[model samples]
Target: MNEFVYHPSGKYLFVATGQGRVEIFKMPELELVRTVAAHSGQSNCVALAVSPDGKRVAVGASDALCFIWSIHETICERNLGRLDYHVRAVAFTYDSQLIATGSEDHCIDIAYVNDGSRVHEIRLEGEVYSAAWHPQQLILALHPRVILVNETVSVYDYLATPVESDLRNKNAHIHCCAYMETFRNDSKYPN
Candidate 1:
């Protein structure tokens, strides 16, 4: 993705290098307004999803840690609850109250935004490359092609055990499932 933000007020962009730095500049003029250190290591695998209103920034790393970077504070204030899985994909709920991470570990780490705490650890099968919550429903979408995984999508309540099961195949392997959102879902998936 191009590292820039454009606007009619003026063309602008923020170039974020995975190497813990970000540079912002105007279009054409390329005037630099800010040069800030953004994070550690190559942020390429990093999952950053900004709230729709542009208020909160959710960043997850290979370390199995999810952080809620509060932008209003002008500093990287990480709301914690370091998960034990790899985060493959990160997204915010419609209200941005819940942060859902799909990982390689056959699970999703559904967390509350305010405190960055996990509300439920949703488990699935195979390598969870992509995951997303229904904007209105509590149902979570799992890639049906996850190798050896039953072609069933799991719908989980906020904290209780999953309620739907007619969609699963029998004899699904318990091991070799994805863990954590880093690779696709939450950081804790067993892969």
Candidate 2:
């Protein structure tokens, strides 16, 4: 398995494998329940994310596509078409209405989860390694594969507009990002 995530319900574990398959396992027992082929040609499943609502799982593969799997049915729900290069990261919005996929193509494409229609496309300065949505809002933070000069994680508003100056982090390569809780709209920290 290349990447694995526990469902938000804590009842199942989703594992993405090098064989382009997603293995679903029952929690506590760790018993394998089912396996769904996520990609063709044995392309490595590089990234995986379970929606916060626990209804779906998104798997990104070296095939340059992202597949949304049904948690209840254990099936390939929908696929976000070819992304141009190996998909490196996948993330779901706070409400699970959208999914964001980051690829080596230097693009973060946000698509609606309901029908797999693209909502927005965010082009980055470098290859994106990770992406995370704000806990209570449509905001997203992306960590690109950085050179020393562009080490900061880029934050964007709901419209995919860059807002890096609003929330700045310096002096470290942000391998990943997450929100422990919701952020308040205030003078210093506005959501």
Candidate 3:
């Protein structure tokens, strides 16, 4: 398996495999529930994401496509189609209305979850290694060489000015970033 993600409800676990399969397993006992042939050919699934509501999942594959599946039905509901490059990361907004995908093409694509409609796109300076949505805000945190927070998806560098000094000369390459749920209620880590 390349990637696996537990449902927000902790009832199910979704596993993405190199053989283009997405397997669903029950939690705790870890019993097999269902298997979905997510991709075709020799392409492998590299990333998996579950919606906040635990009703949907998004699978990213090396075939340059992202497939969204229903958690209850175990069926592919929507295909994100081919991107400019292979997908490296996938994330769903807190409301489960939008999905954010990062690719090796150095771009992040945001799309509507219900209809697979393109909402917005952001091109970064380097390949996007990871992406995460704020737990209580509309901001999106993207990791390339430096951590960037996209506020409202319109401004690319909304928080850049405040953290410019710390980011300078750091030359850090972040593989992934996640917002702590408890931090949302804390004042110290305001989003």
Candidate 4:
């Protein structure tokens, strides 16, 4: 199983495989949450990003499409159609208002979290290997190679289109992400 992204909440981590399924695992305790059939074929669950607030997740699989799933209630809440380009990395802006995705397409696309509406697309000269939202700043990352990127964990304000951002970027990847609040405050909650 190829675990792509571990959300800040720590309540869930996304595991992708060539098996065509994106599996969610409740963290720390390593509890199994649910497995969503992520793509149409056995495409590698190559890239994934979770919204700020922990209510939604965006995963890339099966071609160049990214699907946004609501984790609040589960059961396939909504589908953000084919993104057209094959994404190599993805991240959410602080406040969760926008999402930044980087691709071999050499473009970074930012979209409204609620409607998948394109906000801005930044062109990268080289293929982006990974990306993330800056935890406290408006700047978004495109495959950040640094080891300790300090950013905010993603959460959501669920509404009309589905979700909204809290505007936090936490420097974390699929395996290292842990809810900042939980670790900082020692909260029992998922954070």
Candidate 5:
């Protein structure tokens, strides 16, 4: 498997595989639930994300397409189809209203979850390695060489700020980043 993400409800685990498929497993015993043939041409599925609402899963593939599936039905709900290269990162907004797909083409495409209509496109300086949405906010954090926060989807601009002076100066490469859910200041570590 290339990547796996647990459902927000902890009931299911979704895994991306090199064989162009996604395997869904039930928690506890990890019983295999379903296997989805996700991509044509047998292109690998590289990344995936579960929506905060626990109703959807987005899987990114080397075929340059991201497939959004309904959690309950286990069916392809929509396809975010405009990306030009292998998609490496996928994220859903805090409210589950939007999704962001980052690819090797040096861009992040933001689209509406309901209709799969694209809302904005963010052109970055390099191939986007990872992306995450702030757990309680609209901000989006990106990586590899830059840290960008999207102020708002309506604005269509990113605050291109570096996380640290040393990282910026030394050209440190960040492969991934995530915003932990601390809804009530519960803990600093991931659950």
Candidate 6:
């Protein structure tokens, strides 16, 4: 398996394979629910994301495309289409209204989940490897290589302004990141 993620409702597990296949498994029992042939050829599917409501899923492949599927049916309802380079990561906002994708083209694209209309595109200095959304805010965490050298985690707001940057781990490459929900209700972390 290339990547896998559980549904927010804890009822399903989505698995993406290196051969461009996506399989959904039922929770607890782990029964094979459905399978999707996401990409053509032998492209690797490196990213998979389930929407907060557990009604949708996004799959990112080396074909430079992101496909959105409905949990109710085994069909791709929308496609973010082809990009400049292969997609490395994908994420959905907490409200399930937006989908974010990071690509080897050193760019991040934010699009409406319902219509696939791009809302914003953020260009970075290096290739974006991963992206994550804050639990309760519009903040986005991006794991990108700075100037094709340093692995950095950049925190940005909805407007695409860098609010903070952490370069503590010089030797480690952060492949993925997520915000803890423990501080979601705290006043110190404002949306």
| Cα-based lDDT for every prediction | 0.52, 0.76, 0.75, 0.60, 0.77, 0.75
Candidate 3 lDDT by residue in tens digits, 41-101: 5889989999999888899999889999987787899989747778889999888987889
Local accuracy of candidate 6 as per-residue lDDT tens digits, 72-172: 88679999974778888899987898788988886788777888876667766657778888776666787765532222344443344322242322342
Q: Which candidate gets the maximum lDDT versus the true structure?
A: 5
TM-scores across all candidates? Answer: 0.58, 0.77, 0.74, 0.67, 0.75, 0.76
List of clashing residue pairs for candidate 2: none
- List, residue by residue over 1-191, the lDDT tens digit for candidate 5: 88899999888888899878899999978999898887774799999999999999999999999999998887899899898889999999888987889988877787779888766667765677688988877678876333234321222236422234323223422222322221222244323
Please give the RMSD to the true structure for each candidate, in Å.
10.5, 11.2, 12.6, 13.4, 13.0, 12.3
- In model 6, the clashing pairs are none
TM-score of 4: 0.67
Q: Which of the predicted structures, 2 or 4, would earn the higher lDDT when compared with the native?
A: 2
Mind giving the per-residue lDDT tens digits that candidate 2 earns over 44-88?
899999999988889999988898988778788889974888888
Give the local distance difference test score of model 3.
0.75
Rank candidates, TM-score, best first. 2, 6, 5, 3, 4, 1
Specify the poorest-scoring 10-residue window by lDDT in model 2. Answer: 172-181
Higher-ranked by TM-score: 1 or 3: 3
lDDT, candidate 5, at 69: 90
Residue 84 Cα positional deviation in candidate 2, in Å, after optimal superposition: 0.9
Query: What would the per-residue lDDT of candidate 4 be over residues 22-88, giving only the tens digit for each residue?
Result: 8888888878878787776657667787877777787775477776778776645444453566666
Give residue 32's error in model 2 in angstroms: 1.3
lDDT of 5: 0.77
Candidate 1 lDDT, tens digit per residue, 1-191?
Answer: 21333332445444544554555577789898776555556543355566554666665555565566655564666544445655556667556676777656656666667755555566564545555555664455545234332223443333333223413323321111222222334345545
Candidate 3 — which residues are off by over 4 angstroms? Answer: 145-191
Give Cα distance to truth, residue 173, candidate 4, Å: 25
